[model samples]
Target: MEIKEHIIQGVRIAELHSDNMLLGSVEEAVDLLGNMYYNQADAMVLYTEHIADAFFDLKTKVAGEILQKFSNYRMKLAIVGDFKQVSSKSLQDFIRESNKGRLIYFAETLEEALAQLVR
Candidate 1:
């Protein structure tokens, strides 16, 4: 896992780049938060493609659980990538709701995610 930090509009966002699936468990979520916190990042940006499929499966509830961790720790999370490939209406709805919030967002690109952070 490689974490690159970017400061956009005065907010520090850590962009996580990893070949491994980053969201396999709640423990992994904690680790991610740790990394971001250690880096003094105000927010985290993850490419959707780096996440595991299990994270999005509603039955598993990994997505909610992981996101809750971020919320609990008072960290912002931005997921970026082409979400059109994911064909779940419920997931789409969940993303929509999440995007409405200040802490969590689903964006099409890193630039878009950074834009949301500035807002």
Candidate 2:
């Protein structure tokens, strides 16, 4: 995993770049969060391609579990992806609702995610 740091509006954000899945399981999610927290990153930006497909499946409950950890740690997260391709209404609703908050967001691009996180 290569983390590119960005400071926007006095907030430190970490943009994760990895060829493999970053949040494939709860363990990996916690590990990634720990790494970012130790690096003093207030927010994180990650591409959906780096996340496990299970995360997009609402039935698996992986998204809720992992996202709860992010909330518990008080770390903001922005997932950038082409969500239009997701056919699940529940997942689409989840993304839409998450985007309405400051803690977590579902964005279509890196720039959008960064802007959302900074807000």
Candidate 3:
């Protein structure tokens, strides 16, 4: 995993570039955020390629559980990539609802994701 840290709008964002799946459960979310905190990053940004499929599968409940963990920690999370690839209406709705929030965002590109997170 290659973590690139950036300061945007006074927030420290850790962007992860990983060839393998990094998050799959609430436990993993904790571990991941622990790494971010160790790096002095306030938030995390993950690309679609780095995320596991379970995160997008509403039936798995991984998305809600993990995102809730992030919310509990008061840390921001952003998924940047091609969201159009997901065909589930429920998942799309979930993404849409999440985008309305300040903490979690689903964006098509890293730039747009950063923009939402910085705001």
lDDT of 1: 0.87
Mind giving the per-residue lDDT tens digits that candidate 3 earns over 30-50? Answer: 999888888988888998777
Q: lDDT by residue for model 1 over 1-119, one digit each (tens)? A: 89888888799988888878886789999998897788899998988778888888878999889989999998998899888777999999998998899999999988899888778
> Model 1: how far is 62 from its true place, Å?
0.7
10 residues in a row with least lDDT, candidate 2:
18-27
Q: TM-scores for all candidates?
A: 0.93, 0.97, 0.95
Count clashing residue pairs per candidate. Answer: 0, 0, 0
lDDT of 3: 0.88
Best-fitting candidate, scored by TM-score: 2
The true-structure Cα RMSD of candidate 3 reads 1.0
> By descending TM-score, how would the candidates be arranged?
2, 3, 1
Better of 1 and 3 by TM-score: 3
Of the candidates numbered 2 and 3, which has the greater TM-score value? 2
Clashing pairs in 2: none
Question: Model 3, 119: alpha-carbon shift in Å?
Answer: 0.7
Clashing pairs in 1: none
